[model samples]
Target: MDVDLPYELQLVTDLRGHEERAWQIAWNPVEPLLASCSADKSVRLYNYQPSNESLKFSHIHSIPTGHTKTVRSLAWSPSGKTLATGSFDSNVGIWEREGGHDGDEEAADWECMTLLEGHETECKSVAYSSSGTLLASCSRDKTVWVWEVHPDSDFECMGVLMEHTQDVKCVAWHPSEEILASASYDDTIKLYIDDPSEDWFCFSTLTGHKSTVWALAWSPKGSYLASSSDDLTIKIWKRVAEHKWECALELKGHERSIYSISWGKGKTGEESLGWLASTGGDGKINVWDIREPPESSTGRVLSHKLIATLSSAHDVSDVNSISWCPREGFEDLLATAGDDGSVRVWKVVPSH
Candidate 1:
């Protein structure tokens, strides 16, 4: 079905069996595994094959030791060896992947490494830095805490980022930088940068969205940022100078609240197409291509082409989260989890 735009939705994987809605889905950074957490108080990990788009998922393990309520968010370490889950029980649990390189023989060796408790209310999101050295979490209590990860030592609370006046919805680490970006119900995106000599602090605030900003992501180059919001728009910003940035473009096309946004692959040259993929409450996934402006006297802003639009992508359910594979070779594949109690994988194929 065409929704007044371009883009095709092909069902690559139909991951079912969840008893409740899935709030978060993450693609493993090192392996072809997909981790998803749900309101049913369960966490599942699936092994996906990108060659033929086959999914062989087993309940590798479940968290019975941490949260007494629903599990809402999860994040995998940069090494993909550790998984962090945040839940409504007001705590975060770190899960370690046990067992040696040998397969199923040691599959029952997983364990909960630690329980991070600080938030006075339900934790909304959790993310691990690119180096696997830090983890950041946000909650409904209107606080974001940064944690330092140690191998043989106890995890330390590095710092707490307290700037949002309301609940923080999402937190993302820049691909290769020490900067972090957060979005909140206060309709703003805050950038946190650490000084090499001192602590981390809010360096800048991006104010453009008319509604709650639900998601934020940094481009792989760490030069640009993207945010999606309930205002049904996606805003792209570029860091021009030290501690200075501005919104380069505003993409308006979605009919409902946008829940997630991600950058696509093939961005390597001046003429390379930088794609933005978004999932929304209207049950659609939209792909937009950011193009450079034409050479003319009229200084028009850069334009984005609607490359793809998928209607009924979740079949009447709201897509709550979407993530692109962070590894080098898997850029064309995307994964999304939704209120439909299913996780779907999509592969982008260029039109001839």
Candidate 2:
């Protein structure tokens, strides 16, 4: 069921080194580095540079994270100086360059600065806030923990949220706010905010997905959020009121469970809502252009167009994770991690 897509995903390269399933992919927001974690209990880093007309990626370092179990997720700090790894061992490891340098030559020497431990079970995902002052991690123990980042690689637990009835799958911070969103196996997405007078608490619980919610990504403007689910669908949630959000649209196309989705500012110009890319157990990568309705229209439904579809994106292997390059000039680039233990890079180009 493949057709000529409007945009072509040109193969850039395939990076193979992980010995087990690749679980996640994260691109540094301020640097040209790409990181991926795997079931092999290791995190691999790569350096990419524009080589002539295309980009080239080199395996610069491999970190054998001392976690006793699989490294499930990783995220780069906003400053691109530190990396956080969440593991099945129920601990989060923070790593930084030995000398605190951003040079590619010093990428290999990294030290685990601190280990955050509180979760009673496997940690599913970890993310740093936009200001790099707060970190969030979710676990299979059905709770989400927030950490306050301090100077000299120190961290303090700010809040432990136990609102979910089942395992928490993912946690994502708002693009420009301290508000945090967590998806869970309970088939609900909860949004939490801090009350300066009090502490962190859930302000809203979004319920629509019939099955487990696997991932969540917010729009560039933070006005809308896209979530993928085990029910083989994606739902776009729009913030209508100050503390309320409603499902604006539902996307259905994936033939299997949708495990990952990424929202990025692609070639959609400044006014349009960014592009949404999704991949999952079907081994297909689908990119959609979500358009915000005009101001005059009082309708709640938003329109979307399928711009590209790359079937068998991982060569018959389940595409576990998909991440868009967060750099300025490389907004059209995308990276995906597969169950085959390989990472592939693709460039979106206009079709003739």
The most accurate candidate by TM-score is: 2
> What is candidate 1's lDDT per residue for 112-213, written digit by digit as tens?
888999998998989888888889999888888988898852689878888999999988888777778889999999989877788888999999899999
TM-score of 1: 0.91
Candidate 1 overall Cα lDDT vs. reference?
Answer: 0.80
Off-target runs (Cα >4 Å) in candidate 1 are 3-7, 50-65, 105-108, 266-270, 292-300
- Cα deviation at 242, candidate 1, in Å, is 2.1
lDDT at residue 297 of model 1 (Cα atoms) = 38
RMSD values for the candidates in order, in angstroms, are 2.6, 1.3
- In order of appearance, the predictions have TM-scores of 0.91, 0.98
lDDT (tens digit, per residue) of candidate 2 on 1-352:
3456679788999999999999999998888889999999999988888799988899988999999999999999999989999999999999988753647444358789999999999999999999999999999999999999999999999999999999999999999989899999999999999999988999999999999999999998899999999999999999998899999999988999999999999996976698899999999999998998888899868989899888999998999999989888888899999999999999888877
Candidate 2 lowest-lDDT run of ten: 99-108
